[model samples]
Target chain A: MRIEHELHARRRSRNVGLGLVLLAFVALIFALTVVKVRQGDLMEAYDHQPRVSLTPLDTPAGAPAEETPAGVPAEEAP
Target chain B: MTDINAYDASPEGEFRDYVALLKPRVMSLVVFTAFVGLWVAPGQVHPFIGFCAVLFIALGGGASGALNMWYDRDIDAVMNRTRSRPIPSGRVQESEALGLGIVLGTISVMMLGLVANWFAAGFLAFTIFFYAVVYTVWLKRSTPQNIVIGGAAGAFPPMIGWACATGGIGIESILMFMLIFVWTPPHFWALALFMKEDYHRAGVPMLTVTHGRRSTRRHILAYAVALAPFAIGLGLTSIGGPLYMAVSVVLNVAFLRGCWQIFRRSEDQAIADDYAVEKRVFRLSLYYLFLHFLALLVQSWLGGW
Candidate 1:
């Protein structure tokens, strides 16, 4: 009877450990998916805004200007 | 009542404790600055990439914080400010913190590269290395100038933010970097002025412990004087305008006056006031950086600079 009881306890402990590992893996996957969805929304928003390029040195004094540098390629401009 | 499994010294891992391991205060600053950087970039970035950039930057920042905690677990146990940290408080294992830090650091850098330009991603990777290895591992215990040099680690986010938008570095981004670099010493020294005992207890070799409070006070004044010009100079840049200039003038004058008061204070007076002036200045210094960045954003929006 004693031998049988010890075997049952070992089996239960292993099963609990396996359950915790699976739980942690699932949580990590869920967090990553949420981050991905948020990124998708932001990308869509960026596409909707008007794009301009202006350097800090190029703005005239006292005037509110977008200050895009002349002659810089648009595709490469940030 | 059946004995409930309530207060095990080692309860199966709690979620809140894991979050605490990230050093949320530092992470918040990292996120804020990185956002400002993204916002202030010259052209529009796809909002998705921008979000990814900020997320990765923040994770990188958290990774450094985690690693710092892991490596400093010994000193953390000794300091009052850090005594309750996850690792030091026995809430999380040191190895767990290390593993989390390394895994997060790798993921943040790789994801940043995949989603953003390689330049921005590269900068993120370097920043993690600078904070974790150069500042935390090498400098913290070695010299009085630790904060001076380590300040570079904190200053990189704005530059990285700039890179994310433009795919290149520029004079304005460099100026933004300089502004924080100059501000760090005075802001930190003011805290060191009051917390000298903590440094002494931790044997961390802070300026207060090595050079004495008077010298630290002088250094604070010097750095504050230097910072004024840099802060105001940003006004002359394409990013600057009347709003930024006005904010810069008022804040710089107040900061100078605060530093002057700290310098002129006698030890007896400081003790009598319980270092009230130093404590207040320290609080103001926190506002000082945040306001500068906010002013920049406001100027960019209102003045369209």
Candidate 2:
């Protein structure tokens, strides 16, 4: 059906490989950003870690897990 | 190979020839070793930074390949093993390879510095220079010890990777470097023994070409013997545990036995089986590096598990 198979196979593969590498780099940045956003944008997260949470875990009635940030209101910290 | 200028007949270069310039197969090994180095280090690198560092390291490795192709194109045309490569086959222009090498080398190093520590980027820069200039341009045509010294270029990856994460080197990384360094001669020499004519044809002065086959065989055994302590030594380091130690012991014993088989064989014997022992050992050398690294990964993973 196509003589171009013999013609440009090598070129296509090389372009695809480079394209894939570049795409991966871009995708990683986007993914990491999403992870950071999902993790509540802890800018210092790398010093710790930021990860995506899939299902929200249920909290016990009227109890909060997180300690309030220094001088923050309870509702905002929650 | 047709003419050294085959690409001229084809006009604009095909994409694959550009890939050939990067030498992807070699890049695979470099990237993996560097990944292991980065992984086994003490602290965590941001996943994004880690990914960028490894990608740039791979690009740096590819850049070295381009420069090597640019410099060695003439000899590559003569060697049967290399005659079909892009530069030698005229599928890629010499200037293109050189340009790609310089651009990629510069970008990779600079980006690495921006993303990781300067120490890792600096190490990567030195590695590209060592491979492209020190090993390929200077030593390869000059002496039998070419790969021996040139092997250091390949050996630097893990250290660079460790530095990428830890911003420093340690005994563990040094041992990883030594494992590859000690193993290189025998690996290349075994390939040289079988591809003896290729080196001879290309005037590349590989150990087999400089020394006779007997000497080459002796060198392979000697290197394999020397490699035992280093290989076993690595298993005793922070990276090693019972599982790694066991794998190391088994691998070293099998490797030594393989070398002994090659050592005992005569030229007549090698010819009888088409250098089966040499070929077997060559293939084993690939697995040998791989399994050693795999063992480290296993140790790290299972220990954490």
Best by lDDT: 2
lDDT of 2 by residue, B232-286 (tens): 8987887788888888899889899999998899999999999999999999999
TM-score of chain A of 1: 0.43
DockQ computed for model 1 against the true two-chain complex using alpha carbons: 0.04
Model 2: how far residue B190 lies from native, Å: 1.2
Query: What pairs collide in candidate 2?
Result: A10-B16, A11-B15, A11-B16, B7-B90
The sequence of per-residue lDDT tens digits that candidate 1 reaches over residues B1-305 is 75333334552345556667778888888888888877877897767567778878998998988898999999999988889888888877888899989988998888777666789989998998999999998998998999998999899998898898988888878888888899999999998887755766777998987998889999999999999988988888877889888988999999999999999997789989999999998998888899989998888888744
**Interface RMSD in Å per candidate, to 1 decimal?**
9.5, 4.0
| Candidate 2 docking classification | incorrect
Score residue B223 of candidate 2 by CA lDDT.
98
Candidate chain B TM-scores, in order: 0.95, 0.95
- Would you list the C-alpha lDDT of every candidate in the order shown? 0.82, 0.84
**Worst ten in a row by lDDT for model 2 chain B:** B3-12
